[model samples]
Target: MNALSHKIIFFLFKLKLLQPSESTINFWLQSEDTDKLEYAVTQGNYKTRKLAAEALEQLAKPFSIPALLKCINDKVQNVSIACLNALERISTKDELIKTIVKKRFKWVNEIREKREKFEANKGKKYNIYRWERASKKSFDMVKERLKRPIR
Candidate 1:
């Protein structure tokens, strides 16, 4: 699309009148306007947030990483998934580790550990493995990706 059309669409999106499709997000991702993308990711509705996450996957600016990390704990599942996909797409092993350390999983890990300890002490041995397993898996995937040369 032409610049004018792109601007109009972006304006509409900002007004919350338009829900961005993947193509619209792809167009925006290629734009130089990082602020708009960052704003949408942080404050927009679920659809916009998801689109912003998708855009971030392609753009992958270091400044956008923290915003993307915040989205991982979004109340909306799709938004969270999109953020995760973006993180996986953009982050190197070291970057992923840094993000993990920075977030500390925002109390998620602490909660899991407490729960596990409580369950173990109670002799029930709760099997809530997914939480820790997913974190480990993400780290492992990043490590594996780091071993390969980017095409």
Candidate 2:
């Protein structure tokens, strides 16, 4: 391609107006253009996102960990699954991604549906075993205090 067209395409990438093909995404990955791959994981159509996630999984680069974490909740189940697979692969293949997952995303170990369910309920109040807010200690004004310590 001509330099002018390449510059125009690079501009489009910056704008995220271009719907990249799998090859284009692969090229970006090979060239270590992680910003583009991260964008692809979060922005592109389901197919593009799936492919990008798969590529990231194969690459298993630590920097892609945060992007893959964000993509794990993709509305498309397949894409989310791809994101999960990528995260698992990354955790296994890269120590940094692994440490981050263990420290911050332990729930990623759950199955996708279960993870989503857990995440959904994470903020809700539930009456499980021993689940109660501590009540403030109160005193009755009319109640007389013990005169002295009990023998």
Candidate 3:
């Protein structure tokens, strides 16, 4: 599709005027033009990048994991947060652990620890209050960092 058409579709999708059918997502997942989706994830406007990450999460194909990983470094905090949230949902435990070991992403260790704890507690009900508290603390720290003046 042409650039204008792509923009219109993205706009409609963002506005909720166009709900992507499974086939549409599948098409993007399999098409050679997958680069377009990757480009949007990495280089599109903030809103577009957010939407693309969301779509990748919903599609949840393994191939999209790398793109999602890269998006974690987006300059925009919200875009990075969105990508992180999507990664949590779509990445396997092994992949998350691997990422934790390989990348210095914020909260990667916390995410790995929570995943390990969740696995250990499987088949038994467990309160995640501690995890929630830690996550909130991390988010607050990030917010504070963002507010500070850069050297």
lDDT of each: 0.75, 0.73, 0.67
TM-score of each: 0.54, 0.55, 0.45
Best by TM-score: 2
Cα lDDT over the full model 3: 0.67
Residue 92 shift from truth in candidate 3, angstroms: 2.2
Candidate 2: segments with Cα more than 4 A from true spot: 1-7, 13-16, 93-151
lDDT of 2 by residue, 7-28 (tens): 4664786687877776676676
What TM-score should be assigned to candidate 1? 0.54
Ten consecutive residues with minimal summed lDDT in candidate 1? Answer: 100-109
Candidate 3 regions exceeding 4 Å error are: 1-4, 7-34, 95-151
Worst 10 residues of 3 by lDDT: 19-28
Error of 3 at 91 (Å): 1.2
Model 2: number of clashes? 0
TM-score of 2: 0.55
lDDT of 3 by residue, 1-151 (tens): 5446655765676665764443444456555345556656876678767766776766666677788888887887667777877777766666654565356454656666888998988889765664447888899999999999999
**lDDT, residue 70, candidate 3:** 89
Report residue 59 deviation for candidate 2 (angstroms). Answer: 1.2
